[model samples]
Target: MSKVAIVGVVGRTNAGKSTLVNRLVGEKVSIVSPVEQTTRNTVRGIVADPRGQLVLLDTPGLHKAVGTLGTLLNRMARRSAAGTDITCVVFDASQEPQLEDVGWMQRVAKEAPDRVVFVLNKCDAKPFFSSMFREAWKEASTTPQPSPVKPVWVDCCALTDDGAKGVMDALFDFAQEGEPLFPEDVVTDYPRKLAIADTVREKFLSKLHQELPHELGVRVKEIAEGNGRWAVAVDVLVNRPSQKPIVIGRSAQTIKGARKAAEKELSEVFGVKVSLELWVKVEPNWMKNPKILEEMGYMGAVI
Candidate 1:
Protein backbone atom coordinates (compact mmCIF):
# COMPACT_ATOMS: atom_id res chain seq x y z
CA MET A 1 0.00 0.00 0.00
CA SER A 2 1.11 3.55 -0.65
CA LYS A 3 1.89 5.67 2.40
CA VAL A 4 0.03 8.87 3.34
CA ALA A 5 0.52 11.42 6.07
CA ILE A 6 -0.64 14.88 7.14
CA VAL A 7 2.43 16.86 8.11
CA GLY A 8 2.25 20.06 10.14
CA VAL A 9 5.02 22.39 8.98
CA VAL A 10 5.57 24.75 11.92
CA GLY A 11 8.36 27.06 13.02
CA ARG A 12 9.23 30.57 14.16
CA THR A 13 8.67 33.41 11.69
CA ASN A 14 11.02 33.58 8.66
CA ALA A 15 12.40 30.13 9.36
CA GLY A 16 11.94 29.09 5.69
CA LYS A 17 8.77 27.08 6.38
CA SER A 18 6.90 28.49 3.38
CA THR A 19 9.89 28.02 1.06
CA LEU A 20 10.28 24.42 2.16
CA VAL A 21 6.56 23.75 1.65
CA ASN A 22 6.59 25.21 -1.86
CA ARG A 23 9.73 23.22 -2.69
CA LEU A 24 8.19 20.00 -1.42
CA VAL A 25 4.89 20.57 -3.23
CA GLY A 26 6.82 21.43 -6.41
CA GLU A 27 4.53 24.42 -6.81
CA LYS A 28 3.84 27.81 -5.23
CA VAL A 29 1.02 26.88 -2.88
CA SER A 30 2.05 29.42 -0.26
CA ILE A 31 3.18 33.02 -0.57
CA VAL A 32 6.78 33.67 0.46
CA SER A 33 8.37 36.90 1.66
CA PRO A 34 11.38 37.82 3.74
CA VAL A 35 9.08 39.89 5.92
CA GLU A 36 8.09 38.25 9.15
CA GLN A 37 4.53 36.86 9.44
CA THR A 38 4.19 36.67 5.68
CA THR A 39 1.92 33.66 5.99
CA ARG A 40 -1.21 34.77 7.85
CA ASN A 41 -3.23 31.62 7.21
CA THR A 42 -2.72 27.87 7.38
CA VAL A 43 -2.28 26.83 3.76
CA ARG A 44 -2.53 23.15 2.82
CA GLY A 45 0.01 22.00 0.25
CA ILE A 46 -0.69 18.50 -1.07
CA VAL A 47 2.18 16.45 -2.44
CA ALA A 48 1.42 13.48 -4.67
CA ASP A 49 4.55 11.31 -4.58
CA PRO A 50 5.02 7.84 -5.99
CA ARG A 51 5.48 6.56 -2.46
CA GLY A 52 2.11 8.05 -1.49
CA GLN A 53 0.68 11.45 -0.59
CA LEU A 54 1.80 14.05 1.93
CA VAL A 55 -0.66 16.72 3.03
CA LEU A 56 1.53 19.55 4.25
CA LEU A 57 -0.08 22.25 6.38
CA ASP A 58 2.03 25.40 6.05
CA THR A 59 0.98 27.45 9.05
CA PRO A 60 1.70 30.97 10.23
CA GLY A 61 5.08 31.25 11.90
CA LEU A 62 5.02 31.75 15.66
CA HIS A 63 5.92 35.31 16.54
CA LYS A 64 5.71 37.80 19.38
CA ALA A 65 2.06 38.76 19.60
CA VAL A 66 1.36 42.42 18.97
CA GLY A 67 -2.38 42.58 18.33
CA THR A 68 -5.47 40.46 17.79
CA LEU A 69 -4.18 39.19 14.46
CA GLY A 70 -0.78 38.30 15.86
CA THR A 71 -2.32 36.33 18.69
CA LEU A 72 -4.62 34.48 16.26
CA LEU A 73 -1.74 33.52 13.96
CA ASN A 74 0.23 32.11 16.87
CA ARG A 75 -2.81 30.17 18.00
CA MET A 76 -3.27 28.79 14.48
CA ALA A 77 0.34 27.62 14.34
CA ARG A 78 0.15 25.82 17.66
CA ARG A 79 -3.23 24.27 16.84
CA SER A 80 -2.02 23.03 13.46
CA ALA A 81 0.55 20.88 15.27
CA ALA A 82 -2.16 18.82 16.87
CA GLY A 83 -3.97 15.93 15.08
CA THR A 84 -1.26 15.53 12.46
CA ASP A 85 0.35 12.24 11.54
CA ILE A 86 3.76 13.89 11.65
CA THR A 87 5.04 17.09 13.22
CA CYS A 88 7.66 18.76 11.02
CA VAL A 89 9.34 21.55 12.97
CA VAL A 90 11.58 23.61 10.72
CA PHE A 91 14.43 25.73 12.14
CA ASP A 92 16.71 28.32 10.61
CA ALA A 93 19.91 26.65 11.68
CA SER A 94 21.97 29.41 10.10
CA GLN A 95 21.53 31.29 13.37
CA GLU A 96 21.62 30.16 16.96
CA PRO A 97 18.33 28.90 18.41
CA GLN A 98 16.02 31.71 19.44
CA LEU A 99 13.44 31.76 22.22
CA GLU A 100 10.61 30.79 19.85
CA ASP A 101 12.67 27.93 18.47
CA VAL A 102 13.28 26.58 21.95
CA GLY A 103 9.60 27.08 22.76
CA TRP A 104 8.68 24.76 19.87
CA MET A 105 11.25 22.20 21.00
CA GLN A 106 9.86 22.29 24.51
CA ARG A 107 6.30 21.80 23.28
CA VAL A 108 7.36 18.85 21.11
CA ALA A 109 9.27 17.28 23.94
CA LYS A 110 6.32 17.59 26.27
CA GLU A 111 3.72 16.38 23.81
CA ALA A 112 6.01 13.64 22.44
CA PRO A 113 4.33 13.06 19.13
CA ASP A 114 4.68 9.62 17.61
CA ARG A 115 6.62 10.91 14.62
CA VAL A 116 8.61 14.14 14.49
CA VAL A 117 11.06 15.62 12.01
CA PHE A 118 13.28 18.52 13.02
CA VAL A 119 14.48 20.31 9.91
CA LEU A 120 17.67 22.35 10.21
CA ASN A 121 16.99 24.69 7.32
CA LYS A 122 19.35 27.20 5.66
CA CYS A 123 22.24 24.80 5.88
CA ASP A 124 23.88 26.59 2.94
CA ALA A 125 24.30 29.77 5.00
CA LYS A 126 27.65 30.36 6.67
CA PRO A 127 28.10 29.62 10.38
CA PHE A 128 25.43 26.96 10.24
CA PHE A 129 24.57 26.29 13.84
CA SER A 130 23.45 22.67 13.50
CA SER A 131 25.27 21.73 16.69
CA MET A 132 23.67 24.61 18.56
CA PHE A 133 20.20 23.54 17.47
CA ARG A 134 20.93 19.99 18.53
CA GLU A 135 22.03 21.20 21.93
CA ALA A 136 18.87 23.26 22.25
CA TRP A 137 16.78 20.25 21.39
CA LYS A 138 18.65 18.22 23.98
CA GLU A 139 17.88 20.82 26.58
CA ALA A 140 14.24 21.06 25.54
CA SER A 141 13.80 17.30 25.64
CA THR A 142 14.70 17.43 29.29
CA THR A 143 11.11 18.54 30.01
CA PRO A 144 9.33 15.72 31.84
CA GLN A 145 7.35 13.50 29.50
CA PRO A 146 5.87 10.06 29.33
CA SER A 147 8.59 8.89 26.97
CA PRO A 148 11.51 10.20 24.96
CA VAL A 149 10.79 11.98 21.67
CA LYS A 150 13.31 11.01 19.03
CA PRO A 151 12.98 13.31 16.01
CA VAL A 152 14.45 12.59 12.59
CA TRP A 153 16.99 15.34 11.99
CA VAL A 154 17.53 16.60 8.44
CA ASP A 155 19.75 19.42 7.20
CA CYS A 156 18.07 21.38 4.43
CA CYS A 157 18.70 24.52 2.41
CA ALA A 158 15.04 24.85 1.25
CA LEU A 159 16.00 27.32 -1.46
CA THR A 160 16.79 24.58 -4.01
CA ASP A 161 15.22 21.26 -4.99
CA ASP A 162 18.33 19.28 -4.16
CA GLY A 163 18.54 20.85 -0.73
CA ALA A 164 14.87 20.06 0.05
CA LYS A 165 14.97 16.46 -1.12
CA GLY A 166 16.05 15.20 2.30
CA VAL A 167 12.94 16.73 3.88
CA MET A 168 10.67 14.92 1.38
CA ASP A 169 12.47 11.66 2.03
CA ALA A 170 12.16 11.99 5.78
CA LEU A 171 8.44 12.81 5.58
CA PHE A 172 7.73 9.86 3.31
CA ASP A 173 9.71 7.50 5.53
CA PHE A 174 7.45 8.32 8.46
CA ALA A 175 4.29 8.09 6.33
CA GLN A 176 2.15 5.04 6.96
CA GLU A 177 0.55 2.82 4.33
CA GLY A 178 -2.75 4.34 3.22
CA GLU A 179 -4.61 5.80 0.26
CA PRO A 180 -3.88 9.30 -1.01
CA LEU A 181 -5.76 12.16 0.66
CA PHE A 182 -6.06 14.07 -2.61
CA PRO A 183 -5.87 13.34 -6.31
CA GLU A 184 -2.40 13.08 -7.84
CA ASP A 185 -2.87 16.09 -10.09
CA VAL A 186 -3.94 18.34 -7.20
CA VAL A 187 -1.08 20.18 -5.49
CA THR A 188 -2.95 22.43 -3.04
CA ASP A 189 -6.42 23.04 -1.61
CA TYR A 190 -5.91 26.67 -0.64
CA PRO A 191 -9.09 28.69 -1.23
CA ARG A 192 -9.10 30.67 -4.48
CA LYS A 193 -9.97 34.02 -2.88
CA LEU A 194 -7.38 33.60 -0.15
CA ALA A 195 -4.80 32.57 -2.74
CA ILE A 196 -5.48 35.70 -4.71
CA ALA A 197 -5.31 37.82 -1.59
CA ASP A 198 -2.03 36.21 -0.62
CA THR A 199 -0.61 36.79 -4.09
CA VAL A 200 -1.66 40.44 -3.99
CA ARG A 201 -0.31 40.85 -0.47
CA GLU A 202 3.00 39.26 -1.49
CA LYS A 203 3.40 41.70 -4.35
CA PHE A 204 2.70 44.62 -2.03
CA LEU A 205 5.14 43.26 0.51
CA SER A 206 7.83 43.16 -2.17
CA LYS A 207 7.14 46.78 -3.04
CA LEU A 208 6.61 48.21 0.43
CA HIS A 209 9.37 46.14 2.08
CA GLN A 210 9.40 47.09 5.79
CA GLU A 211 7.21 50.14 5.42
CA LEU A 212 3.91 48.69 6.74
CA PRO A 213 3.98 44.92 6.29
CA HIS A 214 2.50 44.02 9.66
CA GLU A 215 -0.26 46.62 9.41
CA LEU A 216 -1.19 46.00 5.77
CA GLY A 217 -3.94 43.54 4.89
CA VAL A 218 -5.55 42.46 1.63
CA ARG A 219 -9.08 41.10 1.30
CA VAL A 220 -10.69 39.95 -1.94
CA LYS A 221 -14.21 41.34 -1.98
CA GLU A 222 -15.40 39.75 -5.21
CA ILE A 223 -14.31 37.92 -8.34
CA ALA A 224 -16.17 38.46 -11.61
CA GLU A 225 -15.52 35.49 -13.87
CA GLY A 226 -16.22 35.41 -17.59
CA ASN A 227 -14.74 33.63 -20.60
CA GLY A 228 -11.37 32.41 -19.32
CA ARG A 229 -10.87 35.63 -17.38
CA TRP A 230 -11.39 36.94 -13.85
CA ALA A 231 -11.75 40.49 -12.62
CA VAL A 232 -11.00 40.54 -8.94
CA ALA A 233 -11.95 43.32 -6.56
CA VAL A 234 -9.65 43.71 -3.56
CA ASP A 235 -9.58 45.98 -0.54
CA VAL A 236 -6.15 46.95 0.71
CA LEU A 237 -6.34 47.85 4.39
CA VAL A 238 -4.04 50.24 6.17
CA ASN A 239 -4.09 51.40 9.77
CA ARG A 240 -3.81 55.14 9.14
CA PRO A 241 -4.30 57.72 6.38
CA SER A 242 -0.57 58.37 6.29
CA GLN A 243 0.04 54.69 5.38
CA LYS A 244 -2.54 54.80 2.57
CA PRO A 245 -0.44 57.13 0.39
CA ILE A 246 2.61 54.92 0.95
CA VAL A 247 0.78 51.83 -0.31
CA ILE A 248 -0.77 53.75 -3.21
CA GLY A 249 2.59 55.47 -3.87
CA ARG A 250 3.15 58.81 -5.64
CA SER A 251 0.66 59.14 -8.51
CA ALA A 252 -0.58 55.58 -7.76
CA GLN A 253 2.58 53.95 -9.17
CA THR A 254 3.03 51.50 -6.31
CA ILE A 255 -0.51 50.12 -6.39
CA LYS A 256 -0.45 49.87 -10.18
CA GLY A 257 2.84 47.98 -10.19
CA ALA A 258 1.69 45.63 -7.46
CA ARG A 259 -1.59 45.04 -9.29
CA LYS A 260 0.07 44.19 -12.59
CA ALA A 261 2.52 41.83 -10.93
CA ALA A 262 -0.25 40.14 -8.96
CA GLU A 263 -2.37 39.76 -12.11
CA LYS A 264 0.50 38.14 -13.97
CA GLU A 265 1.17 35.66 -11.15
CA LEU A 266 -2.52 34.94 -10.59
CA SER A 267 -3.08 34.37 -14.28
CA GLU A 268 -0.35 31.79 -14.31
CA VAL A 269 -1.47 30.21 -11.04
CA PHE A 270 -5.14 29.89 -12.00
CA GLY A 271 -4.69 29.43 -15.75
CA VAL A 272 -6.90 32.41 -16.47
CA LYS A 273 -6.58 36.03 -17.49
CA VAL A 274 -6.59 37.77 -14.14
CA SER A 275 -7.15 41.46 -13.50
CA LEU A 276 -7.11 43.31 -10.17
CA GLU A 277 -9.04 46.36 -8.93
CA LEU A 278 -7.30 47.54 -5.81
CA TRP A 279 -9.00 49.93 -3.36
CA VAL A 280 -6.74 51.25 -0.66
CA LYS A 281 -8.79 51.93 2.45
CA VAL A 282 -7.62 53.31 5.76
CA GLU A 283 -9.47 51.09 8.23
CA PRO A 284 -8.02 52.46 11.45
CA ASN A 285 -6.92 49.49 13.60
CA TRP A 286 -8.47 46.94 11.26
CA MET A 287 -6.33 44.17 12.72
CA LYS A 288 -8.10 44.48 16.02
CA ASN A 289 -11.56 44.49 14.48
CA PRO A 290 -13.21 41.09 14.77
CA LYS A 291 -15.57 41.71 11.86
CA ILE A 292 -12.72 42.65 9.51
CA LEU A 293 -10.68 39.72 10.72
CA GLU A 294 -13.48 37.30 9.87
CA GLU A 295 -13.96 38.92 6.48
CA MET A 296 -10.27 38.43 5.72
CA GLY A 297 -10.63 34.69 6.49
CA TYR A 298 -8.31 34.85 9.46
CA MET A 299 -11.01 33.59 11.83
CA GLY A 300 -11.87 30.62 9.65
CA ALA A 301 -10.97 26.98 10.10
CA VAL A 302 -7.41 25.85 9.44
CA ILE A 303 -8.28 23.75 6.33
Candidate 2:
Protein backbone atom coordinates (compact mmCIF):
# COMPACT_ATOMS: atom_id res chain seq x y z
CA MET A 1 0.00 0.00 0.00
CA SER A 2 1.05 3.61 -0.65
CA LYS A 3 0.74 6.58 1.68
CA VAL A 4 -1.36 9.68 0.98
CA ALA A 5 -2.61 12.76 2.81
CA ILE A 6 -4.14 16.17 2.12
CA VAL A 7 -1.84 18.75 3.66
CA GLY A 8 -3.04 22.30 4.10
CA VAL A 9 -0.32 24.91 3.94
CA VAL A 10 -1.42 27.83 6.10
CA GLY A 11 0.32 30.87 7.52
CA ARG A 12 0.45 34.66 7.52
CA THR A 13 0.68 36.61 4.27
CA ASN A 14 4.14 36.56 2.68
CA ALA A 15 5.29 33.84 5.08
CA GLY A 16 6.69 31.61 2.26
CA LYS A 17 3.79 29.13 2.22
CA SER A 18 3.64 29.17 -1.57
CA THR A 19 7.40 28.90 -1.85
CA LEU A 20 7.41 25.90 0.43
CA VAL A 21 4.55 24.30 -1.51
CA ASN A 22 6.33 24.90 -4.82
CA ARG A 23 9.47 23.42 -3.36
CA LEU A 24 7.69 20.39 -1.92
CA VAL A 25 5.76 19.73 -5.13
CA GLY A 26 8.94 20.20 -7.21
CA GLU A 27 7.05 22.65 -9.45
CA LYS A 28 5.48 26.11 -9.42
CA VAL A 29 1.97 25.27 -8.27
CA SER A 30 1.24 28.66 -6.66
CA ILE A 31 2.36 32.15 -7.56
CA VAL A 32 5.18 33.49 -5.40
CA SER A 33 5.49 37.23 -4.81
CA PRO A 34 6.58 39.60 -2.05
CA VAL A 35 3.28 41.42 -2.36
CA GLU A 36 0.72 40.57 0.30
CA GLN A 37 -2.20 38.27 -0.66
CA THR A 38 -0.48 37.08 -3.82
CA THR A 39 -2.38 33.81 -3.74
CA ARG A 40 -6.13 34.48 -3.76
CA ASN A 41 -7.28 30.93 -4.48
CA THR A 42 -6.56 27.48 -3.10
CA VAL A 43 -4.34 25.49 -5.50
CA ARG A 44 -3.76 21.77 -5.17
CA GLY A 45 -0.20 20.62 -5.80
CA ILE A 46 0.25 16.84 -6.10
CA VAL A 47 3.52 15.38 -4.91
CA ALA A 48 4.38 11.81 -5.92
CA ASP A 49 7.32 10.29 -4.14
CA PRO A 50 8.69 6.75 -3.94
CA ARG A 51 6.97 6.38 -0.58
CA GLY A 52 3.57 7.48 -1.92
CA GLN A 53 1.74 10.74 -2.74
CA LEU A 54 0.86 13.99 -0.95
CA VAL A 55 -1.92 16.32 -2.01
CA LEU A 56 -0.88 19.81 -0.93
CA LEU A 57 -3.46 22.56 -0.61
CA ASP A 58 -1.62 25.81 -1.24
CA THR A 59 -4.03 28.38 0.18
CA PRO A 60 -4.12 32.15 0.36
CA GLY A 61 -2.06 33.39 3.28
CA LEU A 62 -4.08 34.75 6.18
CA HIS A 63 -3.92 38.53 6.48
CA LYS A 64 -5.81 41.28 8.27
CA ALA A 65 -9.16 41.86 6.59
CA VAL A 66 -9.32 45.23 4.86
CA GLY A 67 -12.18 44.63 2.42
CA THR A 68 -14.41 41.99 0.94
CA LEU A 69 -11.52 40.33 -0.92
CA GLY A 70 -9.19 40.47 2.05
CA THR A 71 -11.78 38.95 4.33
CA LEU A 72 -12.46 36.24 1.76
CA LEU A 73 -8.78 35.32 1.51
CA ASN A 74 -8.49 34.99 5.29
CA ARG A 75 -11.63 32.90 5.40
CA MET A 76 -10.34 30.73 2.58
CA ALA A 77 -7.09 30.07 4.43
CA ARG A 78 -8.87 29.15 7.66
CA ARG A 79 -11.37 26.91 5.88
CA SER A 80 -8.61 25.12 4.02
CA ALA A 81 -6.92 24.18 7.28
CA ALA A 82 -9.97 22.24 8.42
CA GLY A 83 -10.68 18.58 7.50
CA THR A 84 -7.22 17.98 6.13
CA ASP A 85 -5.35 14.86 7.13
CA ILE A 86 -2.48 17.07 8.21
CA THR A 87 -2.35 20.76 9.04
CA CYS A 88 1.01 22.27 8.08
CA VAL A 89 1.48 25.71 9.57
CA VAL A 90 4.38 27.58 7.98
CA PHE A 91 6.04 30.48 9.82
CA ASP A 92 8.63 33.03 8.73
CA ALA A 93 11.27 32.18 11.29
CA SER A 94 13.45 35.05 10.09
CA GLN A 95 10.97 37.41 11.72
CA GLU A 96 9.26 37.25 15.09
CA PRO A 97 5.81 35.72 15.30
CA GLN A 98 3.00 38.08 14.27
CA LEU A 99 -0.65 38.30 15.25
CA GLU A 100 -1.72 35.90 12.50
CA ASP A 101 0.87 33.35 13.59
CA VAL A 102 -0.42 33.45 17.15
CA GLY A 103 -3.96 33.20 15.85
CA TRP A 104 -3.13 30.04 13.91
CA MET A 105 -1.47 28.53 16.95
CA GLN A 106 -4.50 29.23 19.09
CA ARG A 107 -6.81 27.73 16.50
CA VAL A 108 -4.71 24.59 16.22
CA ALA A 109 -4.47 24.36 19.96
CA LYS A 110 -8.19 24.70 20.51
CA GLU A 111 -9.25 22.49 17.63
CA ALA A 112 -6.55 19.90 18.39
CA PRO A 113 -5.98 18.42 15.01
CA ASP A 114 -4.77 14.81 15.01
CA ARG A 115 -1.67 15.59 12.97
CA VAL A 116 0.20 18.88 12.57
CA VAL A 117 3.54 20.19 11.37
CA PHE A 118 5.06 23.51 12.30
CA VAL A 119 7.44 24.62 9.55
CA LEU A 120 9.93 27.32 10.49
CA ASN A 121 10.72 28.69 7.05
CA LYS A 122 13.72 30.93 6.17
CA CYS A 123 16.03 29.16 8.55
CA ASP A 124 19.00 30.33 6.50
CA ALA A 125 18.41 33.93 7.47
CA LYS A 126 20.63 35.39 10.18
CA PRO A 127 19.12 35.91 13.61
CA PHE A 128 16.44 33.33 13.02
CA PHE A 129 13.66 33.62 15.59
CA SER A 130 13.04 29.88 15.90
CA SER A 131 13.02 30.05 19.68
CA MET A 132 10.53 32.88 19.70
CA PHE A 133 8.10 30.89 17.54
CA ARG A 134 8.49 27.86 19.77
CA GLU A 135 7.82 30.02 22.79
CA ALA A 136 4.75 31.48 21.14
CA TRP A 137 3.48 27.99 20.25
CA LYS A 138 4.05 26.91 23.83
CA GLU A 139 2.01 29.81 25.10
CA ALA A 140 -0.78 29.06 22.65
CA SER A 141 -0.81 25.35 23.45
CA THR A 142 -1.18 26.07 27.14
CA THR A 143 -4.86 26.81 26.60
CA PRO A 144 -7.11 23.91 27.65
CA GLN A 145 -8.45 21.70 24.89
CA PRO A 146 -10.28 18.40 24.41
CA SER A 147 -7.03 16.67 23.51
CA PRO A 148 -3.36 17.67 23.46
CA VAL A 149 -1.94 18.35 19.98
CA LYS A 150 1.74 17.75 19.40
CA PRO A 151 3.17 19.23 16.22
CA VAL A 152 6.34 18.08 14.54
CA TRP A 153 8.58 21.14 14.14
CA VAL A 154 10.93 21.37 11.19
CA ASP A 155 13.30 24.11 10.00
CA CYS A 156 13.11 25.00 6.32
CA CYS A 157 14.61 27.60 4.00
CA ALA A 158 12.13 26.96 1.12
CA LEU A 159 14.51 28.60 -1.36
CA THR A 160 16.48 25.41 -1.99
CA ASP A 161 15.56 21.76 -2.42
CA ASP A 162 17.65 20.56 0.51
CA GLY A 163 16.14 23.20 2.78
CA ALA A 164 12.58 21.89 2.29
CA LYS A 165 13.44 18.18 2.52
CA GLY A 166 12.61 18.04 6.21
CA VAL A 167 9.12 19.35 5.62
CA MET A 168 8.47 16.73 2.92
CA ASP A 169 9.79 14.00 5.17
CA ALA A 170 7.62 15.11 8.06
CA LEU A 171 4.48 15.19 5.94
CA PHE A 172 5.04 11.74 4.49
CA ASP A 173 5.75 10.43 7.92
CA PHE A 174 2.26 11.44 8.98
CA ALA A 175 0.60 10.07 5.85
CA GLN A 176 -1.33 6.81 6.03
CA GLU A 177 -1.50 3.95 3.58
CA GLY A 178 -3.86 4.93 0.78
CA GLU A 179 -4.09 5.32 -2.99
CA PRO A 180 -2.78 8.41 -4.79
CA LEU A 181 -5.31 11.21 -5.22
CA PHE A 182 -3.76 12.31 -8.52
CA PRO A 183 -1.65 10.67 -11.20
CA GLU A 184 2.07 10.37 -10.64
CA ASP A 185 2.96 12.68 -13.55
CA VAL A 186 0.57 15.45 -12.62
CA VAL A 187 2.10 18.23 -10.56
CA THR A 188 -1.00 20.27 -9.87
CA ASP A 189 -4.76 20.11 -10.39
CA TYR A 190 -5.38 23.89 -10.33
CA PRO A 191 -8.02 25.15 -12.77
CA ARG A 192 -6.77 26.25 -16.21
CA LYS A 193 -8.32 29.73 -16.14
CA LEU A 194 -7.23 30.47 -12.59
CA ALA A 195 -3.71 29.19 -13.31
CA ILE A 196 -3.39 31.39 -16.37
CA ALA A 197 -4.73 34.39 -14.47
CA ASP A 198 -2.24 33.79 -11.68
CA THR A 199 0.66 33.65 -14.15
CA VAL A 200 -0.38 36.96 -15.72
CA ARG A 201 -0.87 38.54 -12.31
CA GLU A 202 2.56 37.32 -11.19
CA LYS A 203 4.26 39.11 -14.06
CA PHE A 204 2.46 42.34 -13.22
CA LEU A 205 3.40 41.98 -9.55
CA SER A 206 7.06 41.59 -10.46
CA LYS A 207 6.95 44.74 -12.55
CA LEU A 208 4.75 46.87 -10.28
CA HIS A 209 6.46 45.97 -6.99
CA GLN A 210 4.61 47.58 -4.04
CA GLU A 211 2.55 50.10 -5.99
CA LEU A 212 -1.14 49.13 -5.85
CA PRO A 213 -0.61 45.36 -5.96
CA HIS A 214 -3.59 44.64 -3.71
CA GLU A 215 -5.76 46.83 -5.95
CA LEU A 216 -4.79 44.88 -9.08
CA GLY A 217 -6.84 41.87 -10.24
CA VAL A 218 -6.53 39.54 -13.22
CA ARG A 219 -9.48 37.61 -14.68
CA VAL A 220 -9.30 35.50 -17.83
CA LYS A 221 -12.45 36.09 -19.80
CA GLU A 222 -11.85 33.74 -22.72
CA ILE A 223 -9.40 31.17 -24.06
CA ALA A 224 -9.31 30.17 -27.70
CA GLU A 225 -7.40 26.92 -28.13
CA GLY A 226 -6.27 25.63 -31.49
CA ASN A 227 -4.15 22.70 -32.64
CA GLY A 228 -1.13 23.85 -30.65
CA ARG A 229 -1.83 27.35 -29.52
CA TRP A 230 -3.96 29.27 -27.04
CA ALA A 231 -5.17 32.87 -27.30
CA VAL A 232 -6.19 34.11 -23.88
CA ALA A 233 -8.29 37.21 -23.30
CA VAL A 234 -7.71 38.67 -19.83
CA ASP A 235 -9.28 41.59 -18.00
CA VAL A 236 -6.89 43.42 -15.68
CA LEU A 237 -9.03 45.21 -13.10
CA VAL A 238 -8.00 48.37 -11.33
CA ASN A 239 -9.94 50.16 -8.62
CA ARG A 240 -9.78 53.65 -10.10
CA PRO A 241 -9.19 55.39 -13.44
CA SER A 242 -5.91 56.88 -12.21
CA GLN A 243 -4.43 53.41 -11.56
CA LYS A 244 -5.21 52.17 -15.08
CA PRO A 245 -2.34 54.06 -16.67
CA ILE A 246 0.04 52.80 -14.02
CA VAL A 247 -0.78 49.16 -14.89
CA ILE A 248 -0.48 49.98 -18.60
CA GLY A 249 2.89 51.75 -18.03
CA ARG A 250 4.48 54.45 -20.24
CA SER A 251 3.42 54.00 -23.90
CA ALA A 252 1.97 50.57 -23.00
CA GLN A 253 5.35 49.08 -22.08
CA THR A 254 4.19 47.68 -18.76
CA ILE A 255 1.21 45.83 -20.14
CA LYS A 256 3.21 44.63 -23.14
CA GLY A 257 6.01 43.34 -20.92
CA ALA A 258 3.58 41.59 -18.62
CA ARG A 259 1.77 39.97 -21.53
CA LYS A 260 4.97 38.76 -23.14
CA ALA A 261 6.32 37.31 -19.92
CA ALA A 262 3.01 35.68 -19.08
CA GLU A 263 2.80 34.17 -22.55
CA LYS A 264 6.24 32.61 -22.25
CA GLU A 265 5.49 31.11 -18.85
CA LEU A 266 2.02 29.97 -19.86
CA SER A 267 3.40 28.38 -23.00
CA GLU A 268 5.86 26.41 -20.93
CA VAL A 269 3.26 25.52 -18.33
CA PHE A 270 0.66 24.29 -20.82
CA GLY A 271 3.17 22.91 -23.37
CA VAL A 272 1.61 25.06 -26.09
CA LYS A 273 2.12 28.45 -27.72
CA VAL A 274 0.22 30.84 -25.43
CA SER A 275 -0.63 34.42 -26.32
CA LEU A 276 -2.41 36.96 -24.09
CA GLU A 277 -4.70 39.89 -24.88
CA LEU A 278 -4.72 42.08 -21.79
CA TRP A 279 -7.46 44.69 -21.27
CA VAL A 280 -7.07 47.11 -18.40
CA LYS A 281 -10.43 48.14 -17.01
CA VAL A 282 -11.01 50.67 -14.25
CA GLU A 283 -13.89 49.29 -12.20
CA PRO A 284 -14.52 51.13 -8.96
CA ASN A 285 -14.30 48.64 -6.08
CA TRP A 286 -14.10 45.53 -8.22
CA MET A 287 -12.84 43.67 -5.18
CA LYS A 288 -16.16 44.18 -3.48
CA ASN A 289 -18.19 43.34 -6.57
CA PRO A 290 -19.69 39.86 -6.16
CA LYS A 291 -19.98 39.13 -9.87
CA ILE A 292 -16.40 40.21 -10.52
CA LEU A 293 -15.18 38.12 -7.61
CA GLU A 294 -17.01 35.06 -8.96
CA GLU A 295 -15.55 35.64 -12.42
CA MET A 296 -12.10 35.78 -10.86
CA GLY A 297 -12.88 32.45 -9.05
CA TYR A 298 -12.54 34.04 -5.62
CA MET A 299 -16.15 33.24 -4.76
CA GLY A 300 -15.95 29.67 -6.03
CA ALA A 301 -15.39 26.64 -3.85
CA VAL A 302 -11.81 25.41 -3.56
CA ILE A 303 -11.14 22.30 -5.64
Q: What lDDT would each prediction earn against the true structure?
A: 0.94, 0.93
For all predicted structures, in order, the TM-scores are 0.98, 0.98
Q: Which pairs of residues collide in model 2?
A: none
Q: Per-residue lDDT for 1-303 in model 2, tens only? A: 999999999999999999999998888989999999999999999898999999999999988899999989988998899889999999998999999999999999999899999999999999999999999988899956433989999999999999999999999999999998888899987889999999999999999999899999999999998988999999999999999999999999999999999999889988999999999999999999999999998998764
Q: Kindly give the stretch of ten consecutive residues in candidate 2 with the minimal lDDT sum.
A: 138-147
Q: Which residue runs does candidate 1 get wrong by more than 4 Å? A: 144-147
After TM-score superposition, what is the CA distance of residue 185 in candidate 1 from its true location, in Å?
1.0
- Pull out the clashing pairs in model 1: none
Scored against the true structure, residue 190 in model 2 reaches a CA lDDT of: 84
lDDT by residue for model 1 (1-303), tens: 999999999999999999999999999999999999999999999998889999999999999999999999999999999999999999999889999999999999988899999999999999999999998888788756443899999999999999999999999999999988888899988889999999999999999999999999999999999988999999999999999889999999999999999999999988999999999999999999999999888999774
